[model samples]
Target: MDLIAKNLSYKPTDQFHLNDVSFNFKNGNLYTILGRTLSGKTTLLKTIAGLLTPDSGEIDFDGKDFLRTPVWERNVAMVYQQFINYPHLNVFENVAFPLKQRKMETNVINEKVIDALKSVGLSGYENRKIQELSGGQQQRVSLARSLVKNAKILLLDEPLVNLDYKLREQLREEFKNLFSKGLADETILIYSTTDPRETMELNGEVIVLDEGKVLQVGPAKEIFENPNSLKVAEISNDPPMNIINAEILESEVSFEGISINAPKHFNNINNKSFKIGLRSSDIILNEKGYEFEVELAEISGSETLLHLKKGNTKLIMSIEEVMNFKIHDKVKINFKIEKAYAFNSNGDLASSPFRSKNG
Candidate 1:
């Protein structure tokens, strides 16, 4: 089912859970909600599930107000961070509970329950009690329950938070594969996470929320490479966009005691005082480029992160090659002039003819 929320805001204790959040969730797409704890990620998911109503907004499901419909008729299933199941009930009973509630035929329930368990890789363990299962198994059981319900909208609120690192990675793929089963006409997966890997695995549109405010919502590539505002730029995990103060003269840009030849487009900025952003991948350790001292180096397997300081300004750059410098090592940094972003004093990004805004 396609869901559309407009002007969604909720105020419980003078503090809002959502701040005029608006987005149209496509029918058959895996959508992820990314934010910190108090950023209203869970609250937004709950609002969609009909657990809590927005103080001022409307949720439309195919031109009908979801709020006006009864909660039971919303056709939405929610799987939270906790793996909740009937501890006394066996896996089969737990998986078949929703089907029994709907009073489906015995043969049909058996077919659907077995299908769900098989999708979660728990086909032969149906008679085992939930308490006898591992954390991952129990979480899979929870997922199975949601899947067996045949709900259109799947609200997963940090469902893999309790699993260990390895299991978390493993289950992430299993859950994603569940979407291909074709159970519903359209399944909209609303996953909430602060982990970048989860968002990376899903590889869909990402909505970054900060303290109950909607920072930005767009495809992952556009949001990462061409953020329209500073708030969105601050939450990027791939080396938060490089920002440095720079001044544009008649035909030159001066920064960090280095002046580079500026293009004619530099003179057309709407504002004077602006900051320039450079991606980590764009800068290199070229001897003929700008010079600086490497203050810190963080090694993360294949790629190395270098924290370089130019005078009092510090910048982060990532290199695919192995780290060759130690702490306090002086290195000359070079960057491609074509791969930079200029933003005005208001933090609004400046247009670059060389770079598309939707990159």
Candidate 2:
């Protein structure tokens, strides 16, 4: 099923929950709403699921008005962070509940119920009570419930939030592989979360939300590599992109009071003022690099986050290997000039006026 949201906004009392937002998703693709907490990610999902009606705007599904349709008749299945389960019901009953409510045949219900359980790797535990399962297992049971309904449109609101790291990763792979094997391009998967693992690795189209506004939306790779706004870059990455205030000159760019060859993107620009963004992975520290004072170094597994302070900019550098840089370490940091991006004071990307193939 195709989904389209046009200029959706929600305001309750004095709070502006959602701003004017618009986007469309075709069948057979996974789309993720990515933003920081309180960024209206969940609100957008709820609005789409018909749980919260938009104060203004329209929702269309395959050219039909879905906002006006009854929730049950919308054929949209949702698995939310706060799972819905009948505390009084057993696992079997809970999984079969939706089908039973629809009054499907006994044979059909049994077949679909078992199939759903197997799909979620929750086979053979159907006889147990809902409270007997662990948090992850219970979440799987909830997923099975969504699958059993055979709804073409699926909405997942941080469904893995309650699960531990290992279970979450494993389950993510399971879902991805299942859908890939099926290759159903007609089934739309809309997941709302702040996890880069969910949006970036899954190749989902990311819709960046801030407060109630849809700041940006695009393919995962494009958006991550070149975020239009500083807020977008900060909210979209694990280590966040490094931003340095660099003064543009006739021959090159200046950072930390050091100058480098004119970058390919700026090979022709005569502008004297601009800001440059360098991803953590793009920063290289060497004796011959640009000198910036390191204020802090954070070690995370194999990567080290170097928070450097130079002049007025605090640039974040993502180093691949763990380094023993102390606080206030004076070091030279270099970047892949061609791969770097330049943004103006207004947070908009500005390509080098000088045309270069490297950019």
Candidate 3:
């Protein structure tokens, strides 16, 4: 099945709205909606699931209009951030509820329920009451319920948000393996997450949304490495991309009492002012670049994060190797021009010097 949303817009109030959002998704691939809180992630998923109507636009599945289709008729299963299983029922009954609703044979429902539970690593918890299960176990039961429905589209809205960090990590890998193994072949999975690392770990196509607007959509790595706008660059990074105000001079860009050679694509834009985006990993500690004082340094696992400042601009650099640098120490660093992203004064990406590598 293929899903398409054209010019979808929804406005419940002035503060929250979706504006002219659009996308094309095919079956057999996982698509992630990456955004922060109140960024309209849930609204978009609801619209696709036929739970909410778009103020203006159309939704089509395999070229068939589903704008007016009833939620039940859409053959979609949605799992929410909360564990939504029936509290009064046992795991087996909860997992078998959807099958029973469809009036399947008793033997078939039993077989399917057991199989689904096994797939989610809850093989022997069938008779356990929902109230007796841990948070993670309850979530597994919810996932089992969704799987038993055999829906063509699966919508997951931060399904792992309620689990502990370790459990969330485990389930994340399980979900990815399930999809990759073709267990859900021809099924369209739309997952929404606020964590950038989660989006990256899924290794799927990503749609970045903010303030109800679609910022950018592409492969996870592509979108992160070549964000099309300033908002995208900001939304795609966990620590946030380092943005510096710069003026495009005659062959160089000047900022914060320093000047650097302008990228080839920006040579024609001389005299224009723009914002440069540098990833924390792209900022190298070297002896041949601009000097800055380290305001703070933190060691996290095998990596070191140094907060450096020069004049009024603050930047974060992630160093994979161990460094003895401490706060108040002056260090020299260089920006990897090829990895830099430049946005115009209007916040749109103006130049990407290394985009061809992805092409």
Candidate 4:
């Protein structure tokens, strides 16, 4: 059965939290809602879970009206970013809470809780107290609790967001393993995250949200490579794509007084002013290129992100190695003309490097 949400809108105040959102979520598929804070990712999830009602929308699940159903009867499970568990109850009891609330048989509850715990790699942590476990383990407990329900719809709202970096990486791999191994074969899983990297790692159907609106939805890679608009490109990218105003004249593209031979991807387009979108990785350091002063340099992990400026243009380049550079340091950089994306003046994508034709 598929879950269909049509024209969902919820405006509690002056702004719309879910502005005309609509999508069909199929079973046995993982969908990621990618957005920043207050982008309505949580609002959409809560509305689907029946935790919050929308001001206007139609929710259909298995050919029935889902919005009409009570939250307790919706047969959905949600795992929050924070570790949520009963402080007085141990792992076993915490996971068994849902089944107990349903007054399920003792034997069935025991079997289900054990299976859920095993699925989350916490098979032996049943008797451990909540306070006695680490943050990751506690999250596992929360995950096991959600998994125990075996709900038709499973919503994970940034479940690993609070964990340490190494732990988050470990759990992310584990999650991919779990989801790919048919553990949720009968459920529709919806995960939300602000991390573009995390969304790419999951490699699922991606729904890009921005300011309470659904900007674009497609395969994670497609959305990454061919963001429909400027907003989608910015939100779907980790460091946000660098945008620069440029003009196309015959076979050349000019920006900030610098001109380069336009790639074949933009050949069909008319000579006009367009916005160029380039990923940080697409810009490279070259000794024979234009000189730009370093505005800022940030070291993250094993790479260095250099922010540079030349004339009126600014760009960020992602260097593969861990290098040190000071502010105002002069560096020569070149654009990978073949990897540039062209956006119309209205911010809609006019051409992409991955696409053969221009709009």
Q: Which RMSD values do the candidates have, in order?
A: 3.5, 3.0, 3.2, 1.2
Cα shift from native, residue 275, model 1 (Å):
1.7
What is residue 307's positional error in candidate 3, in angstroms?
3.4
Q: Give Cα-based local distance difference scores for all models.
A: 0.81, 0.79, 0.86, 0.93
Mind giving the per-residue lDDT tens digits that candidate 4 earns over 211-277?
Answer: 8999999999999999999999898887889998889898899987788999889987767888899
lDDT (C-alpha) at residue 143 in model 2: 85
Off-target runs (Cα >4 Å) in candidate 1 are 127-135, 161-166, 180-184, 250-252, 261-271, 294-296, 321-327, 352-359
For candidate 1, give the lDDT of residue 293: 86
The numbered model that scores best in lDDT is 4
Winner on lDDT between 2 and 3 is 3
Candidate 4, residue 88: how far the Cα is off, in Å: 1.5
Which ten residues in a row are the worst by lDDT in model 1?
A: 350-359
The TM-scores, one per candidate, come to: 0.83, 0.89, 0.87, 0.97
Worst 10 residues of 4 by lDDT: 350-359
lDDT of 3 by residue, 192-233 (tens): 999888899988999999989988889998887778888888
lDDT of 2 by residue, 65-95 (tens): 9899888888888898976888798887899
Which structure is stronger by TM-score: 1 or 3? 3
lDDT (tens digit, per residue) of candidate 1 on 140-188: 8988999899888988899988888779888888866665555434788
